[model samples]
Target: MNRKPADTEPVTNAPEWTVSSLSGALKRTLEDAFGHVRLRGEVTGYRGPHSSGHAYFGLKDEGARIDAVIWKGVFQKLRIRPEEGMEVIAVGRVTTFPASSRYQIVIESLEPAGVGALMAILEERRRKLAAEGLFDESRKRPLPFLPEVIGVVTSPTGAVIRDILHRLADRFPRRVLVWPVRVQGETSAAEVAAAIRGFNALPRAMNGPTGPVPRPDVLIVARGGGSLEDLWSFNEEVVVRAAAESAIPLVSAIGHETDWTLIDLAADLRAPTPTAAAEKVVPVRLDLLAAIADLARRHRGAMMRLGERRASDLRALTRALPSADNLLAGARQRLDLAGGRLVHMLGAGVRRHEARLAAAGQKLARLSPLVLLERARARWATAAQGLGRGFAHGIERRAAILTRAVSRLSLQPLRLRAEAGRERLTIAGTRLANARAARLAAERARVDNLWKLVESLSHKGVLARGYAIVLDSEGHTVRTRAAVSEGMALELVFADGKVGATAQGEGAQPATRGRKRKSDAAAPPPVQPTLFGGGE
Candidate 1:
């Protein structure tokens, strides 16, 4: 790859050049070479903008330095003025003066490089912290509007502490716990983090008996305006994380209006300056008083409106109301009429109810069961006497007939009947014996046939004849496959004896298929025979 020539290399190789010409050439070359360049260095001698609308400054570090200038137009555009020891970026053309044989940059635009670089770094850190959900809006805590005890983390003697105290005193006159800490240099961030943690560790009820204790309701991390490097401690990751992780809400106020640091992004709130942070932390006394007066005025107005509405309603209601004299007169007339009617109706109802009660009592008296029963009992007694008489007469008639029957019987007739009875008994005995023998034989045959039928129908007989009669524990015959499910114990009755067996899967059949013929499915399902035979 081809490379470009170095800037230090001479443009032309000529030997007939004078010292002044060489210097002029070098100055021109330098101007051409370094035009519109941006250089970063620490500000050493920064002169504030003059009436000529120009700023003069010298940027230097420990090892190297440069002279810089910025026009008034550019200086006016800066939000924060440059100060000595401030680091800055100078965008200008590098030009050499032949008289002094020195090169300097004529700045068209100037910015504090430290602030820009810090801003860039803060932006990057913000993105990373946001990705980690540390700077998420959801993670941000709302500051208490009326904090009982406000905590301040700042330098002990700095303007930030004084401003916060004055503002807090003016706004609420509440005790602010100033956790003194360095606001700059190496130990500032550590001290700030420790102060935050310390406040957070305090018990929530630390406020005194009559007043709210020193538990910080809100934390203010503040510092006065300074160079970027002077304020860099607040931008440290420890400080940012501490502020971000604080249980109490944190407000970051570092440097001036143009300074933005990583701590600002991590904190719940960011204020431009310490005084501004204090102003944000609490309401101004005058503003609060004015607001209270305004609210009181609004409240009074609202009450007046409400009272007017109520009065209007009352007027409407009064207009809608009936006249008291008329109403009372009408009510009196109604009451008089009602009283007269009520008296008449009550008297009539009483009379009517009395008559009805009298009639009911008479009817009840007429239907009294005691009188009816007495009468019935008398009739029953008469009927019973008549029945007794009839019974006596009937008994006497039967006795006469029996006595005549006895009189008609004679000894000769009795003897002939006795002889005839003996002959007939002899003949009856022979016939009875023959008939009994035939009947016994026939009964034996019938019993044998019945036994045969019963045996054929019996579950024991079926099991003996190469058929199995399975029954469940309840003695219900297992007719269908499903009735004899696997793992079921069954009674297998044979002609001679009975055996218990369990059904395996192979012998089970679905009950649904045999549901139609369920009645004839098994041999009477094994039933407990009663002594009298089948169940009644």
Candidate 2:
């Protein structure tokens, strides 16, 4: 049913609503409109994964920011952990928080909006820190062999502390100074960095109001494992710089072994977990005890050996001791016995001498012939002794004679060699003369043969054999018929001399210049017989 407006002016009729009513209606409208929104935004002012397992953070774009929450159930089921400044796509219902009087997204599902974007940001930041040399392996320090006090920069009330403390207790315990700081949030990175610098600034030898200004020998910047965004605080430039610049040997234990952050690279040593960091900081009590026992055993054995060696030396010294009187008495006894033996040996020697003399007397009769022979040998030796003078004289005379004969014989040998050399020289001279005569005769015979051969091959020889030699007008010999032509003046070389004549062709007649000699016309002159060419 429609009711009419009750007003003086019926034309101005608008419904009125209370503020609470209007707000409620508006909230409902928003919830219905975007009941399940899949919004993509970068997380801002993220502060949760708190004790209650709920996340409270703001999602913001360049234009605006809205409150976002992740309930325990939703967060537990999320594949990625929430972190500040992380871009994420949140699937949830838009609901109004009347108490805070702000509208927020009650997130039912959350995921990394863009892995590529996240990784790109991560890599960029990584390269930036690396360029600053924060991630250099050389700049990292070694963990203290045994830090008296360990300063940890982390959440004091978190499981990370508990795990570290429990592990320290289990292994070799140390005095741990917990510089409690929020492990995650917008300001977490700054707070953590401040804590690290503060620990470094502590006096090593002085006590402070809080018991001691703990200058920790080693530092552990640790955290429970989370997503890359959740662990981003440790990767922050501030946090990484703090870790790298620490004088204390820092041990980075950010997450599980698989999880890595920039701090891990910058730290001197990186432990896989808080517990492992505790384990790495010091050695086990039982192991130290075992080592001490081994040392003690070896020391005791060495002492015993030394004592035994000293005892052996003492025993040998004690045995070397002797009484002076006893030594003198022993020497006297030995001397008296030696005197008695000497007297007895002398008496025995005299008896042996008498016995040998009797035996020699009995052997003398049998050796009488040998004695006669010795006498003869002595006579011969005496003669030989007397013959020494004569023997030397005879040897000298014989040597002189032999020397003279040898000298003569040496001269005869030289003279005989000279005679033989002279005879050989005479024979060589005769042989040389005979060889010279034979060489001359052979040379003369070769010359004669060569001359005879020359006479047979001469041009006079050819003319005498009835062959005429023809010469051209150039005074050149025309051996071939082709060299002369008809009407060419040529010289005809006969046996006696050259005759000038005219060349004629084979069909032309030869004209006689003058009458031939009577003897030449009758018959060719008979060849004269001679031993050589010119003579013949």
Candidate 3:
């Protein structure tokens, strides 16, 4: 068999790519194929937003799952935020993450799937607002019986406004402030809310371009009938909150009577129609006038009847009174009887005075001055005797008290107390002295132990154990022989002291050798070990 040369090799046509290139190609292909798509699926694995303000989640159906991401800007603009288990239709471009080698959808816009989803969202919002007490009946205000200025929030061109105006005219006319706004669309809710707030912000009455613009006394938010989607603006949280926070009474007349919105719950009154809102705000002018007239007539008649009844009572009282002549006849008879009794009373008084004079004379004789003086003297003498006896008894009682006090006064008990106090003082002083001595001893021992520990850990201890340290002229430790050079200034520190010397090369001999030999020959000096090496 013939083998091909080593340099000769067979080659086939095939494309080559790096991982990044392949990923890029795949991403471009996927994006070009599905530039934009609307996918309806149930959201899953939604764990809210990341710290980066971007949201990550998965959209899955019964069988398949696709990763989804919402950029911060896009997520903030979304009307309906994606929640776990929520069914929504996402509109965005299909893209790939090269790092993870996965395909995902970059969501730009998201919304609930259909009417069912919308209803679910609506119910959830209702429950939330209700929990905040915004929809409570107690929070609702009563509509003004007669509003001077009425504000209508609706399209000025719509028939609803015309109906309201005509009805209000038929009943009691009022100043109407029309805040024209879009009835439906993306800006509908915001426009309506602004209109409500604008009306509230207006001064009670302010000058306008054409004429005076009076702030609305009663606000009527009215619109013609429509489906739930068309009427959804009234159900927005902004519009409902505006109605709830309205200072002036508000009437909600949106859609047909059967169609309910959240604003109706917060409004002061819910009219079935625009015309009904008008009727409810004001009473019928003619009927009111007629009622007033009837009341005036009844009041006048009642006052007249009261006056007549009082007059009759006065006449009856006058007829029942006694005749003046008859009254005078009785007075004359009493006067005559009084005159006859006056003479008899005068005679009896004189006789009674005589008897009183006789009794007074007898009392005067019995109370003579001499007899009174004698009686007073007898009483005085008796009192004097009683006082003497009392004084004598008081003196005897005081003497007995003095005798008892003298017996209780003694010196023996005081001496015993003084001795006991002295003994207590002595014992206290001895205990205090012992305690002071013990504290001083303990402190001394502690200080000695600390001093010993410091000595053991210090470098001085190493020097004392026959070890010496060598330092350069700069006082830096010379740990290796290489750090030394010929003629270098050196320092040697031992336990006893530090010595300065000039370094000599290894071949140099010691200067003290001759002196040391002479001394050694005379005394035969015992050998002594140097700090690092023995003498040569």
Candidate 4:
């Protein structure tokens, strides 16, 4: 090989490279040789996650297998998780692992190969979240026209935040709180989710210690535009759920206009870009001021036109009105004519009224006040006498009542008290006498009733009523026919005496309870003629 000693002092025998140096050279050669390349293969043996957040897996086709690794950053930015047997196209540079003497592609970006695998996963998640009403239009809140304190959840160092702040400043200066978070990579989804929740959990009012952060009236979750892989954190379920559940209105400015994430659908509002989100939040200050001025101008012009129109109308009315001088002249003419007539009429009327008044005065004078006064005085005297008599009667009656009351009151002393006791005793005696008399009356009445009952029940009484009592020879009463046997002797008692009797071989005849029967020859009642020609 020919060597030239020039520009760089001759490269000394290609510099004896050690193993580390050789590996270094190979790594650089591989990286530069491959540059950025895309390859498609099926993922295999993807066990799960590593504590360091890197993923190790195998990419294989039917013919060959190669170990592959994705660093935490690149793996987290992947739209869909790498599952075993998924076909993916990875874009990255080839690098070697010195210990294992193996080469693999360090995936810078990854996607489903010739397939909508990520899209399918995204759609599935969307459907699931939508079913849960997370994406409901009804749940979407209206963004506040101007937030008091706007919270931003994004990478603190990104241009997105700068763009947002600049736009907001240009439109309307607002109080903004930045919740610094990772916009992409492994912890980005979790950090974004945590930031959203933290903003929501902040106290609404800051009277006391507001702690490190005050609650935001509206939250903006934003990131700059990139590949779907770059925006994958926003699509994460945790991030989307956090956005959906935020009571504070959330604005999703996730990426450029064409880039959409799950958070965009879940947020209260979606801005095409971070700058656009700022614009959406508040109107341009100058524009608002101009609008106000225009309204004021319109209002003033309207008022002026109204006032001019009213003034013109007033002028037209004034022109149509009769002159004050003419009105006064007409009124004066009428007043003059009426004044002369009124004066003439007044004179005539006064003369007539004066004549009538003279007559009336003469008539009134003919009536004597002395007569009327005398009559009134006479009536007054009668009324006065009556009133005096009534007063005297009332006084006498009152005096009598007072005298009685005084006399009664005077008697109610020692002697009167003793007399009252005696009176009470006498009253007790009287009540005792009345009670004895009532008892005597009741006893006499009872005795008289008993006597009457005895007399009524006596045999003499029964005989007197034409009834008899029968007795056996032994003097026992035979009350029933069955008790009287044939040939048995019986005794009958009457009010005056008793008689002996015998049963003539037959039971005793039943005594008739009524008076002797009276009978006549059979004869029918005479028939009477009916007025309707029927015999009765």
Give the alpha carbon lDDT tens digit for every residue of 484-534 in model 1. Answer: 656666798666678999777787653342132335422232332222234
Which digits, one per residue and each the tens of the lDDT, describe model 4 over residues 439-510?
557645654554465456445678998777887644445666766667777888887788888887555564
On lDDT, the leading prediction is 3
TM-score of each: 0.43, 0.39, 0.55, 0.41
Give candidate 3's whole-model lDDT.
Answer: 0.81
Residue 482 of model 4, lDDT score? 64
CA displacement after TM-score superposition, residue 229 of candidate 1 (Å)? 2.7
* Rank list by lDDT: 3, 4, 2, 1
lDDT of 2 by residue, 1-536 (tens): 97666775446458898878878988999899988888999989877688998889999999999998888877765645667777888899998986667999999877677657667666877888888888787886666677788888889888999998998888888898899998886678889999989988888666777664657889888899898778877877778888889888889999899999888888899999988989999889899999999999999999999999999999999899787887799889999999999999878966865675466556544434334334444665575456556655755675566556666777777557646655765575567557756755764575556556556755567899988877655444565555456787888888877889977658443433322234322332223323223331
Off by over 4 Å in 1: 1-123, 170-172, 207-213, 301-309, 324-536
Clashing pairs in 3: none
Q: Output the worst ten-in-a-row residue range by lDDT, candidate 4.
A: 514-523
Q: Which candidate should be chosen as best, given TM-score against the real structure?
A: 3
Q: Which TM-score value belongs to model 2? A: 0.39
Candidate 1 at 520: error in angstroms? 66
Model 2 scores a C-alpha lDDT of 0.76
